[model samples]
Target: MGRAPCCDKANVKKGPWSPEEDAKLKSYIDQYGTGGNWIALPQKIGLKRCGKSCRLRWLNYLRPNIKHGGFSEEEDNIICSLYISIGSRWSIIAAQLPGRTDNDIKNYWNTRLKKKLLGRRKQQQQLHPATTVEHDHHHHQDHQQSPTSTSNGLSNSALERLQLHMKLQTLNQNPLLHNMLWPKLHPFQEKLLLQAMNDENSNNNIMQLPLLPQPIMMESPLSNIGNMMNNNNINVSSYGGAFQLGGGDFMMGNLDNGTTSSLVWWSNEFETNDVNYDRSGSFSSSSNDSSWDCALRSSDDAGLF
Candidate 1:
């Protein structure tokens, strides 16, 4: 059933507030407060306006002691801090800063502050294009820097083990993708490393494996998961506190014990197109998914093994 209108839409003033209307609203409010019921305020004041509109105009524009100028540095800091802690609940944030309306704060954030932050980020990325690259290099140098391992983080060893465990699990599940990643070996590198370690021959050819490009090792396990899911009719998204996924498309055994916390696939670019990188370090896309050379497969194929 259709819901009833809140007020007579045809009878209300709908555009920019004229000077006379603003003066009338201001004069009416100066004589009496909102009376805690905005719906009744417009009618009592003889305004041909919706009650909600009257309330918004009064609160945002006609409120006493309202600050209409640019926000100060202190106000900016307050808004940023509150936003970080409580997110974009502008009304609550506005309550913390007196004389600042929620709508004003929102407009400032969307039009100015957000762009300012993004501009800073773009500047940094342009200034230090190799920042992440250098970071990854230093990470490697740390391990090779000393045999005793000078890292102060006590959990580093456990974290490394967890990472390897995750990589191994993903490799096992998607051998074809892993095979392409290791161009020099057909899934023999990791297996060889494990074999050498088990046989106490870790100083052999396996030692050379670490010299190879380590970026691919850090590539996400579920790298193309969005495409895989889309191809499989699986819709994955987060709601409230947990990951949610449900469809009668697959076996119940694949759904594990109600926890999708480990399935960390966070990319939204899963268009069914192929991405190609030429020798000049530029990428081009093909028109059709069939022509693409992606290592990913339909989740159906991945599940077969």
Candidate 2:
């Protein structure tokens, strides 16, 4: 069935409201007020305009006490804090800020403040603590150090002597091997070694080797090897080795360590099939289409989500 028209079309006043009509509405409203009833407002105000038109005029342009300008730093901070806590509840945020509309605050936050805060956070996290500490320590020790000694715990002179000793030791032990290995190792390997040493110094376990699974031939073979690998603190290297042994065609999957039966089934299925599956790409496309359809349905139901 077709829907009815909004209002009776025969005698309805259309187009721009004249100054005379506006003045009459304004005068009547001044005397008795709009009383928040747009439907009855035009009748009370003695105007030939619809209630909806009057409401739109007052809200969009004629409303008093509205603030229209760039936001201050304090307002920016308040908006940021509110956004983090409440997400996109702009109406609640607008209520907290006097003279500010929800629409204005939303636009400002999305277009300006969000990007600036993210950039500042990234910059702060990139500063190197080791370089900063060393520079400060050197400045402090320069004033307090004597000719023969230094104030720092591991003094500059002592560090230099230890470095020279280490160099001499390196020359004495397999000099060619040391040079070749040191130069050949990637920076990532050096960083890993440093991290491992730090963990050891702090009395924490540093995993150096990969754990690979052994093939066990049982009558039922109901147990899941992936679950066992996860329950134990197995490393990625071990995972790679296990992957190779299980037949290099199985796609990497994450299963609960406790669900041994499921894991075993999955591994067995993959081994038997040995088929290349690009399921992720298809799944993503389907999800996107579903989301778009949901959004369209929501829009049809209401003006907002």
Question: Deviation in angstroms for 72 in model 2?
Answer: 1.6
Runs in model 2 lying further than 4 Å from the true structure: 1-28, 43-53, 110-305
Model 1 alpha-carbon miss at residue 119, Å? 1.6
What TM-score quantifies how close candidate 2 is to the native fold?
Answer: 0.31
How well does model 1 score by local distance difference test? 0.43
Q: Which stretch of 10 consecutive residues in model 1 shows the poorest summed lDDT?
A: 209-218
lDDT of each: 0.43, 0.38
Best by lDDT: 1
Which stretches in model 1 have alpha-carbon errors above 4 Å? 120-305
The digit string of per-residue lDDT tens for model 2 on 1-305 reads 87975445564587887878767766666676779798777767666567787876665335566676677766665565444322455765666666787777766665566544433323422552221111122344534422331222222222222222223234444322222111111222234333432332243444332111111111112123334335433332324212321232112232223533122111111111222222222211121111111111111111111
Error of 1 at 27 (Å): 1.5
What's the CA RMSD of model 2 in angstroms? 26.3
lDDT, candidate 1, at 272? 24
